[model samples]
Target: MVLQQRREPYPHWEYTDPSGAEVLRVVPERGGLVTGWSSLGRDWLYFDAERFADPDLSVRGGIPVLFPICGGLPDGRLPLPQGVFTLAQHGFARDRAWELSALEGGDGVRLTLAHDPHTLAAFPFLFRLSLEYRLAPGQLGITAQVANAGEDPMPFSFGLHPYWAVDDLSAVRLEGLPAEGFDHHTMAPATLAAQLEALGEGVDLLAHPAGPVRLRGVAGGAAVTLEPDAPLDLVVLWTDPPRPMVCLEPWTAPRGALISGDRRLLVDPGGCCSLSCRYRVDRGWG
Candidate 1:
């Protein structure tokens, strides 16, 4: 799928699978929406908000989660990183335009975004983000491949922010996680020894009777459940003040800055970090 840009403002590009079965519109001004996923009946699922209303979450949908490189510099009160001059929020991957590299596969579409000297100045690493949005028989697979093209090893964290629609948050029951791993984002590692133990046997989210998970209309509202394979260590469920969407973020990094304070990575100009996951939705009875 290739979109011809005409310098128009709202929608910068558009993508359609070979059969034209699914279409995604990229709007620079409106936050890219996987606008049409008929395979799943257009039930809003996926997250990237233009602006995170909660002071807690700084990233919105379709935004490349970046770091050295975490959301808006600590406390919205610091100069840009040394040797950097770009005006992007956290990293340059999200703000800069992404080119559609390829979409001719058996499953879905693949998009690529790369960084150069200019982007390195901000995040200090030569990297390529290849995002693949693949739609298979009954699931939507999302994969992010981060390759380090710089000479030095890079140390960073990453995650995905997808907003899914739900009937209500309170009525939704999240399964497959520890009942007590809900510590404050700022909790120190040392202070969590006890708390971590208190969280009885980790919840096995992948054990739903149907197979992995089950998202149904609970108590008159909708619910979402993710039964991810082993690598996804944390799952964050979020919803804005009055929005109808819920964000089920699977992360390799926490929301805030790294507390242990260690930043060292060796890329040798060709290292990479890749994360992949998928979600299947079966909206029960509208």
Candidate 2:
């Protein structure tokens, strides 16, 4: 079986593994967003069907790439040494269109979004953000590369928000994280010692440099492993009620990086930095 790539009528690109047991779909015109992923005939990623149909609405599901800033600033504006600019929550990379750089033999696809006048006005920096989506035997790899194309150094944060389908929120338990994480909503440190079972409210686990995290009890009796690479310092666990999905996000910095300047990565002029993670899905021992 050979890998395959096709463009569909819905106006998106689809990539499938050689055996057809895995599939990945991306919409380049819409933020180069990956809207669907399936493994072993099971849908592993969640898509908001209604939002996918509405062009005016932001796609709530899939893996949305957050760049320049992960969560939010103190207000709706960012204060840089150059000047202050108004930025939106979760950054603008997810809303803007990306150019398809390469789709490699169906096993991987690389898409890029470079800074333009519109992005410059909001972020005041020249950068190139490249995202590559690759599929292996039982894993999916996402790599984000940030290049500082400006004359001066650039400060930014990034994250990948993947809404994974689950059987039930109460049935999910995340392992391999410390007992404490920061609460972005309350702007304080919190504990996750007991909230794993009753996380209907949601929680963000501050980054642990120790190791990867795993989400058990996913739909179809499968478990997903999140193995993050360097510079990714945070893992956010959140769920949207009545949606049957949970987000295991890997972020470069915690919330309020733009204001607090905590753990934010600074790329020197002509230098580049990258953050990557792998998600491996396998049958669970139910």
Candidate 3:
């Protein structure tokens, strides 16, 4: 459907049906943040225009896509140009307007974002990124693929940030993860890695793993499953102390300064990087 831009409390473009079910929201020229649904939620999502607005802040369990890296930078400075690679935190893709190339049939909607000379100043590569959100009978599948369109190879990383609401935080349970995992605090890199190694597959409260992997509330319960390939090795769960929302973040790599020796992924010509996950909700689990 041809979506129209909406300007009000916040500058955004919305696409929906006659019944007012929201499909998508594109915020261009500000942060290139898209808040809405390609399939799931079908209600609301959040993207920030100001990176510095919360340089040390991030939301809980909703899909927030991180292109280059995740988490805050030391000294609160964006780790590009001055760091090893020039790409900004989370890269430049999230800061550009993606063209809706296709939204038809059962294939789903395809949003494409490309890089030019300006972006190359930070990333230094010609590339195209496509995000596909496909909806089927009872599931929402998300696929993020990147292609190197430049003559040379490209290096990058990506993450998914989806904020999910449970009947209540106290009632939600996360499964398949250990009771203790790794902690990636800025001041204690060695300690974090050691803790990660110690816990192995255990859930680290620092990483926020809630057992049972199910959300429960007075209304009902919902489930989330993450199946990422070799590239993605970490999952993060975040939530506000009293809010009903939770964010599930899957990452290809950890987010940190370029020199930290972990924030890097190289994509050769025609190379691609992708991460996928599924979300489903059921009633009466509370």
TM-score of each: 0.67, 0.92, 0.68
- Per-residue lDDT of candidate 1, residues 1-286 (tens digit): 4444434323345555556555454543222224334443353453443353332554444323443333434443323234423333444454455555445664566666677666665566677777777764346777777788777665555555565555654444444444334433333232223432322322111111222444454222444455454333355444453554445556554433333232222235687766676776555533
Sort order, lDDT high to low:
2, 3, 1
Ranking by TM-score: 2, 3, 1
Q: Report the alpha-carbon TM-score of model 3 versus the true structure.
A: 0.68
Stretches > 4 Å off in candidate 2: 1-10, 101-106, 204-209
lDDT of 2 by residue, 217-259 (tens): 7887688989988777578887777788888988888877868
The candidate scoring highest on lDDT is: 2
Local distance difference test, per candidate?
A: 0.48, 0.81, 0.53
Q: In angstroms, how far off is 89's CA in candidate 3?
A: 3.9
The predictions' CA RMSDs to the true structure, in order, are: 7.3, 2.2, 6.3
